[model samples]
Target: MAESKIPIYGAIGANVAIAVTKFIVAGITGSSAMLSEGIHSAVDTFNGVLLLVGLHLSKRPATAEHPFGHGKELYFWSLIVAVLIFGLGGGVSFYEGIQHIRQPEPMRDPTWNYVVLAAAALFEGTSFLIALRQFRGQARGVPFWEALDRSKDPTTYTVLAEDSAALAGLAVAALGIYFSHALNMPMLDGVASVVIGVLLAGVAVLLIAQSRGLLIGEGVRPETAKAIRAVVMEQPSVEGVGRVLSMYVGPDEVLVVVDVDFKDDTPTGDAADAIAAIEKQVRARFPMIRRIFVEASDAPGGDASAARPGAAS
Candidate 1:
């Protein structure tokens, strides 16, 4: 969890500096795309702060009111960040773009816009590389989109998404500024702002979907569930493993409940011992499983041989 902070901090720093620069440049150049970019950077800066707050709150110790700790606080805040991206970042940009298009302004010299765009790209690119490196470490060998879908930590990926959008927006802004000046089509700058808004909205929608799923409850990956099932079935005294229910309680915490059927003639003491062994082995294999509940069943027709491995609820 601590490692997740590195990229977020880097992003916050870059966005803060860039936001100030973009706003100043926008005022000087009256470029609609530059103003939209300024808003985007400001929103990103705030989002980074919110993410850090979420991370800090999520580290709070569990209490009676919330037995699972405050882990989901991170998800909640992530959801908020997504909404803000859609509202303040995307929605505002769209509005500004339309307004600018309706009342087209004269094209100004794009020299400052070009300079700021170049510098913003440098900072944003560096931040993106940091976030991508962090995400790659977590992804191991998994493909990019697949790993992003499987990731539980939002900080690294969220920063990556934001930086990607920022870099893309810079490109669009540069093009808009160039075309508007060269072709005497000032409305093109507004078109660029709208495009940037669309990009941000798309990114926000994806983040919202992921954060919502995690907040509701997401289980471990299929491979992980299968491995856990195999571990349980390896016990000699165990007859069958039923539903292996699991959910992520936090980025690094999982709660698992397993239904086990011991051999019909196995002694209660032996079953208890088997349960203990299963718990130990499962924890050893997956340190993220913080809480485990094992239920020994004696009901008739308890055969789970036909049950698919890791088909947990």
Candidate 2:
């Protein structure tokens, strides 16, 4: 995910160029589609800044107050990104698009509009490819759907979604530019702007949904659970696992609580030794699991000890 940030930054850099160019082209041609594309690119620039902030904040060291680490901050900030997308990006574009539809302005110098769109599309495509390449390495060893379904790093997903939308929006912009040029109708440009707005809104909604899950402290993925269980159960002296609780507190960190039973009767000292061994094994197996709380199962006739006291029922 760290490496993936490079492409996101690159995409942001390119958007700055694209946005400025589009603004100039839009003003010169008076094409609503170009203006809308400019707005989309502008939002992308802001999203990049937020993504950088999220990437940094999400990596903060765990504190006494937040033993789970600062991973959840990624999701919270990402949720803010979604809200901005919806309110600032989507709302503004939607309003502008409606205005264009109501009183369509005739496009002037439509030829230049097409040229600017083509250039933007190329730049956006390049940025998108870089992001895809970055994600490729991170996504390996994990199922495609699973990576997206369980990933806690909002920067990667948000950038990917934003890049995809930018590419699509550029294509629509090109079409609108063409039609406005061929048919001498500027309303087509406005219609294209509306389409771009809808796309941004849709992606924003998705970001909101994902961020909400993270903020609420979603549990680990099923595959991750299976892996953790397997690791815990592999010790020869273990009888069976009683419970394995895991939650995402950050992008690459998890809080783990496990309960296990011993295979046979053992002395108090031996039980302590076994617990220590199990803790060491679990840590070695899961470097990503930063915090682990283990408790020995109750003796045959005794009550269980709490690993995480006051855990939700």
Candidate 3:
């Protein structure tokens, strides 16, 4: 959790500074793209605040009402962030672009636009590098796309995606400003704003999907499930391992319920011992597994059908 905050803090600081500069420049230059960029930075600043709030809320202790703790608070807030990005960031930018197109404004000297953009790029780039480094450390050498697909935490990736989009939007704004000034076609500025909106929308949609999955209780990776099963099978008193049900209750916390078949002749006391051993081994192997429930069955073949309806043999 401490690590997650590093990138978010960096992003918030950078976006706040950039947003103010962008709004000032947009006011001075009357460039549609610059205005849109200002909105984008402002939206990003707000999103960063929301993410921080979510992170803090998610640290609350578990209560009877929420046995799994408040981890999903982060997911819920992340989803809200995505929605805001779509509505406020993307929707507003696109609308502003269309309005500018319908009533084009005369182009002004773009010197300030270029200056602000260059400075924004520098700050945004620095923030992006910080986020990328954090994400890479978390990925632990996993390929980029694959790691992103498997990531349970939203903060690092969300910042990464936002920064990446921001960089791209800056490029488009630069081009639009250049072309509008060079060709004396102010409508081109509006086109650039529209493109930035579309880009933001695309990124928001992806974030929404990812956050939705986590909120709905996504499970561990297949390889992790397989490894857990292997650990149970290694126990001498165990006959078989049944369904290895698991869910990520928090970024670094997992709840697992495994169906274990102890040898039919094993006494209840020995079975209990084996269950304890199983829990210890699993926790030792995977510290992220915070809570584990072993459903032990003494039946031959370790069948758990009686204990869990629809449980596989």
Candidate 4:
């Protein structure tokens, strides 16, 4: 989690610089596309700060109010970033575009706009590469898209999406400024602003949808669950593995509950020892699983009912 935060810090620095330049150019040139890009960068800067706060909050130890720690705080903030992207960034861009369409203004110093945009694109591309590298590490041997879909971390994906959109917006803005000047149709610049807003809204929707699942208690990856089952079955004192339930409570924290049918003739003392051994082995095998519950029964079909709530680790 700490290592994953570098991208967010990088983004904050890059976006703050880019946004200041963008706003200055937008004011000087009166380019709708440039104004839209400024809004995008400003919102991204704020979102980076929010991610940092969320990361810090999520790392807080479990408290009386939050027995599982503040892990979901990150998800909550991620959701807020999505809403801000759609509301403040996308909505304002769309409104500005429509106003510009109704009342076009002759741009001043178009060359400066080009220079600033080029620089902004360079910065944004670097940030995108950083996020892409981390994402690729998580992707491993699997398909990139599939890995992203299954990723448990929200900060990396948000930064990646923002930077990718930033680069695309720069391209669109450049084209809009160029064509609007050459063809003497300033409405195209307004159209470009509208496109940027639509793009942001779409990205926001994607983030919101993905984060919603995670906030609502998404389970561990398929492989993690399978490995857990394997671990439980490998125990000598266990006759059969019943059910294994798992969920992610934090970025790197997992909660696992397992039910096992022990050997029928095992004594009470031996069963207690077996439970202790299983817990130790499971924790050693999967260090991320901080909270674990193991239930023993006489029959494989014995209803473990549901896991009893225990103190979070």
lDDT of 2 by residue, 220-267 (tens): 777767776777677656678777788778777777787877655645
Can you give the TM-score per candidate against the true fold?
Answer: 0.93, 0.88, 0.93, 0.88
Please, what are the lDDT tens digits per residue for candidate 1 over residues 1-313? Answer: 7689999999999999999999999999999999999999999999999999999999999899997788889999999999999999999999999998999898677899999999999999999999999999988899999988888888888899899999999999999999998999999999999999998999999999999899998988889888988998998888887888888888878888888877887766676667778778888888788888877666224533422222112
| Shift of residue 147 alpha carbon in model 3, Å | 2.1
Task: Give model 2 RMSD, 1 decimal.
Answer: 3.6
> How does each model score on lDDT?
0.88, 0.78, 0.89, 0.85
- Evaluated at residue 110, the lDDT of candidate 4 is 91
Ranked candidates (lDDT, high to low) = 3, 1, 4, 2
What lDDT, from 0 to 1, does candidate 2 have?
0.78
Candidate 2 steric clashes: 1
Return whichever of 3 and 4 wins on TM-score: 3
User: 1-313, model 4: which lDDT tens digit per residue?
Assistant: 7678988988998999999999998999989999999999999999999999999888898779887788888999999999999987889988989998999987766999999999999999989988888889877787988888877788899999899889988999999999999988999999999988998999999999988888898887778778877876776777987778887887778888877787766666666666666677777877778888877657333433423333344
Give the Å error, residue 96, model 4.
1.5
